[model samples]
Target: MLKTGSHIQINDTTLRDGEQAPGVVFTLAEKVAIARELAAAGVDEIEAGTPAMGDEEVEGIAAVVSQNFCTRVTAWCRLSETDVDAALRAGVKHVNISAPMSRLQMRVKLKAEPDEVAARVTRVIGYAREKGLEVALGGEDSSRADLRDIGLIAGAAAKLGVFRFRFADTLGLLDPFSTYEYIKRLRDETDLPIEFHGHNDLGLATANTLAAIRAGASAASVTVLGLGERAGNAPLEEVAVALPRTADARTGVDPTRLMELCDLVAKASRDSIPRAKPIVGADIFTHESGIHVAGLLHDVRTYQGLDPAMLGRRHKVVIGKHSGLAAVRSVCAAVGLDLDNSVAARVLARVKNIAKTTKTLVPDARVRSVARQELEGAETRDMAPARAELRLHP
Candidate 1:
């Protein structure tokens, strides 16, 4: 939903660039399923795959095109006739044709002069337009490219009727503050629709993406669960959850299914989502601290920003050293622990010692086990030990 004047659209690349994550491959069936999910999640577009790859790649784009799930599917390609022919053969009507606008990509990769590549882009855009396919011009290494020359390349694409000009931090080296400044200047210079594509080598993709939107980016490229080559790209779920709540802009991502989508990316990608990942992590809503559990029992808002119920999650009170007496009582109430003052004291002492020794949060099952062992110790000894003991049962 557009609120007033928010500038944000999602061009998800989970199936395309995200699959480029080393050692991760998505089968045809897997790619189609993810494309459908991305469509269902309200993303504006999907960068399906590179058509120039092979028949398998072409078939994948066709599979997504066949579904036609209200998402525009585009292919990434060089600004060359061969790549354009492959894209057309794959039946994808939209393509992001690009070249090295930077001295790095142009000089090193293309090994062509600046003026030479710029004219080549214009010619290819005209060719794609003639083929009746919509186009987005990609400035491959704009982060390191001269800003004035970048604008000139973009203006050339604009002159050829390309509206979306994607500025890529191909090396994942740009910071959030610098990203905003450059993108802000870019928007002022051209009327083209700006899309920010960031990488996570510096672990700043999501942060920089947000800054880009705040500065006037039309869309931000993202992947599910932050899956991409090397350090991966900005996470689609994180960008969705953070932007609307944190920025003047908003995107159309389903907040409730954010975790479910994270799970989907993890399972399909065969990578485990971290337990502390924001918004959708396994432990994000699971409270193990005694103090936190106590506060949560009174009101979940005391411990969580968004309600667990909203994400179809239940709040769990686990026994840990950081937990207070109220949390202990709550977990016991949930699990029928029913401990008296003496038993509670023994359990609390055991929790403290365990956390201190392990240097980590104590788990609930361990607390319950310790309580049982303490009962056994008292029963066996007939009297409490003269000194304290924090012993493990197993």
Candidate 2:
């Protein structure tokens, strides 16, 4: 667990590298809104965009940087000096200088040797620094690169007064254990600040990112709703909310703004947030089991992990197949229906029958209405006219 005392800096890449995801393109207005949301939410850095993509991208990056949202805006770039120049021209005070790290990528793709690439990395950092921009050196496919060579590239950049060494899981090849070991070794051997970037090819990016943080990574590259190329990167909201509760780490993020970012990003990308996604998803804190609802009614911590209030969410006790008497009673109480034992059992059995008959989760309204009918029947049969006490079962 992190000490919960250190300042956890979140670096949101939603506008820049996140757009690299297939079929994603953010308009200038969307980019501006995202940047504003990121800033308002207290993200430490925003990878605004790649100005080198030309006029539109440059204008977008400039618009974000000029917002004065109290966040550092960075632009991504290739190893070319002109890319750095473009970022500078776009008013980005921070630049991520990327280089292919794997032998396959460096030679086969870039057709450049390590010596040549290392020299280029150092040159870009130097030029970016001279241009009054902080330089973050990115290791594209760094996980697949030979460790010794990566160390050399990272070390060379560090010697040049670069800001940080960005180690990437370009292919999502790393699991948590491997990520821990690799990140630990890198941290142990280098004084450069390390930032970990993970992709979700194996559905392990968030897990690996957590491992990397535990192994001394100072920063991470994340996107809203895990948006990125291929399988996607770690979801920024998950990392933001999960870290504080489980690892006892502290991120300077506004918990309330977390879901809003998800919504904003989803709208901008023309995508929808998955209902079952953790932290920012619609159903993460929604409860349906009768037993689960009873527990929540007693104390929200019964089945909940992180507090829903942290994310500007309310506790939702949903009535479904698994619910029992107490769950029904709780919902009834909320709706001003208190049920007795007999009423509770009847309601519970009816809910179960409804669930079985439909083979689907029963919605809260139908369960409550059925319970109300039973309560009305019980009143008509009795002379005392006592209040209905409901106990819903799971």
Candidate 3:
């Protein structure tokens, strides 16, 4: 487990990896805007873009760099001198130089053996350092690579004074157990700061990332909404919020601004935020179930795990098929209606019927109307009993 108060660095790759999601693109203005928001949200670094993508990408990266935000802005680059040159042109002081780590990638992508791959990575790290670029070496497909080979390359990069070694679960194939073991073994390899870059193909990126951190990785590479190639990468919001709670660690991220930042990215990418998405989801704090709403009414802690107020939001109670009398009364009271027990029960019945028919939450307006009708009927019934008693007395 991570030590208490361990500060995990958040390296957000929203502009680079996030935009790589199929059919997703960000305009220059949007890129700057996102970088601004990311800095304001207290990310430790922003992977602006891959400078090697060409002038357009370089310009985009440069635009973010020109903003001079306090957060470090870094460029992604392949393990080549040409890529490093592109990064310099983009005016970024830091660069993450990537190399194929798995034997399959080395044989197919680089067409080399272990010795040749190690030589190439060392040469690039030296060249980048000579060019005055702060460097982090990224091990592509590290999950499939042998631990010895990872140590070899990272150990070599360390000699040249690289700042960190990024172990990427490039295919998102590792579970939390495997992730912890891999990172733990890698820790014995080199003294370089270890950063974990995880993918979501297995839907375990966040879990794997946490495991890696517990095993001694100091940094997490993430993107907004988990947006990336294939399934996506580890989500920034999930990792940031979960670190303190689950790992006894903390990040610089502000949970309160996460929703706004996520909404901004979702809109720019033309992707709708899933209403049930964790952390920033619209319905994450919305309650409609009978048991849950009753529990919340009695004591919020009964149904509460993550506090919505931490994200600058509150719990919302809506009447639906699963709603109980407590939820109905709460909804009615919100609209300036007072429902006695009898009226509340009648309104809840109507709500369930309406919700069943519509296959949706019963609107507050409709609930108010039903409450009014029930109240009028109850009043008429009460007056009749008094009138009969008076007639008998006369």
Candidate 4:
């Protein structure tokens, strides 16, 4: 149902929500470096940080803003004039003013009702506009809120000239189907652009994000490596790579730079990127299974789904317990050892045994050793037969 070639804006929140992950913090230099990388990766916007966190946060956000990258840099703020003042000090031209959308959050966090929340949104947005700041309204805990309340709140913000409305699945609660319906309903309420922000508690953030875009969201809020509070947010790499294929949508993001960008974030955050992570993972394109490798050898399309070349990487073949003769032959050729079928078969058995015993892929050095030993043994046996024939003839 999506319109093909729709342009989706990628608003990266790695500096804001990503740092909210417990025990995670980025130095000012790291923040600037990350911002530069995000810009180079062609993200549309960067949510720098919460300015209201105090002077240090303001300074960090300002440092990133000073870089003057082509990507628009925005600050996340509370629905308060004081936060807006801090954003101004941080020198960002845009701000995302967040307010609780659910009754539970409104009563518990802000001690206010729907009307009161609406009034606060109006006051803060008006103040931000007067200060020459572009504003976006962020609906916190929107997944659990009433659709009517969301419409009312977003309608008020629209009247005040907010550029976008962000529907945040703050608790990561909704599935894709529900996400689609929720976003579709919101899309009908007002003419404002809707951005979808998802959490990964149920491991469905990426899926939910795609659903929201299909339903009507034109912008996606994502963090590098899905780093954020609790389980985390939807990952930037996953969402960017998935958009074109899943929703017939595209972002300005460059797929090739995703790995380098993710690596920089992982190192700065002191977190390790999981080897199996999609798009940016170290092993996503690696193959070892016999059937898969055999198919890949015949025609890469037989077993290939995502082409690694798109991401500036290539398919890697390794020797493992599940590896077959095709894999062994391919790997050996890479290491400058071309083995015939019989020698390859012998090498395969040894590689499997070593992999099973070590509970890991057999290293290339070990494979080469085993292959050379097999080839030498084959030659010795052949020479022995010829020697016996010569002795018998004499």
The whole-model lDDT of each prediction reads: 0.81, 0.85, 0.92, 0.92
lDDT tens readout by residue for model 2, 1-394: 2455666678989998444578889889999998899899999999998888898889999999889778888899988888988887899778889999899999987788888888878787888788888888899998998877888888889887887888999999999999999988887657788889999999998998888888888887888888888899988888887766545577788989888887888887778888898887788888887677777778888888778887778878766678778878877888898899999999989988988899887787888899889998898888666789999999
Candidate 4: tens digits of C-alpha lDDT, residues 1-394: 3578988999999998434589889999999999999999999999999999999999999999999899999999998999999999999999999999999999999999998999888888999999999999999999999988888888899998999999999999999999999999887777899999999999999999999999989999999999998999999999999999999899999999999999999999898999999998889999989999999998899988999999999998888999989888887788788899899999999889899899999987889899989989998888884434445553
Ranked candidates (TM-score, high to low) = 3, 4, 2, 1
Clashing pairs in model 3, backbone N/Cα/C closer than 3 A: none
lDDT of 3 by residue, 296-385 (tens): 999999998999989999998888889999888887788788988878988888889999999999888888899989989998888884
lDDT for residue 32 in candidate 4, whole number 0-100: 92
**Native RMSD of candidate 2 (Å):** 6.4
Query: What shift in Å separates residue 274 of candidate 2 from its native position after superposition?
Result: 1.1
| Candidate 4 regions with alpha-carbon error over 4 angstroms | 17-19, 335-338, 385-394
Q: Please give the RMSD to the true structure for each candidate, in Å.
A: 6.4, 6.4, 2.8, 2.7
lDDT score, candidate 2, position 193: 83
TM-score for each of the candidates: 0.88, 0.92, 0.96, 0.96
- Pairs of residues at least 3 apart in sequence or in different chains that clash in candidate 4: none
Q: What's the distance in Å from true for residue 96, model 2?
A: 0.5
Kindly provide the TM-score of model 1 when superposed on the true structure, using C-alpha atoms: 0.88
Model 1, span 1-394: residue lDDT tens: 1255484889888888433689888889888888878888888889999888888888888888989688788998888988899899888889998777688778788777778787888888889989998899988878888887787778888887886999889889899999989898887667888898999999999999988887778799998888888998898988887887667677777777777666777888888999888778888878876666767777778878877686678766665567676766555656777777787787788788888888887666777777778767767787655877898998
Clashing pairs in 1: 289-323, 290-322, 290-323, 290-324, 291-323, 291-324
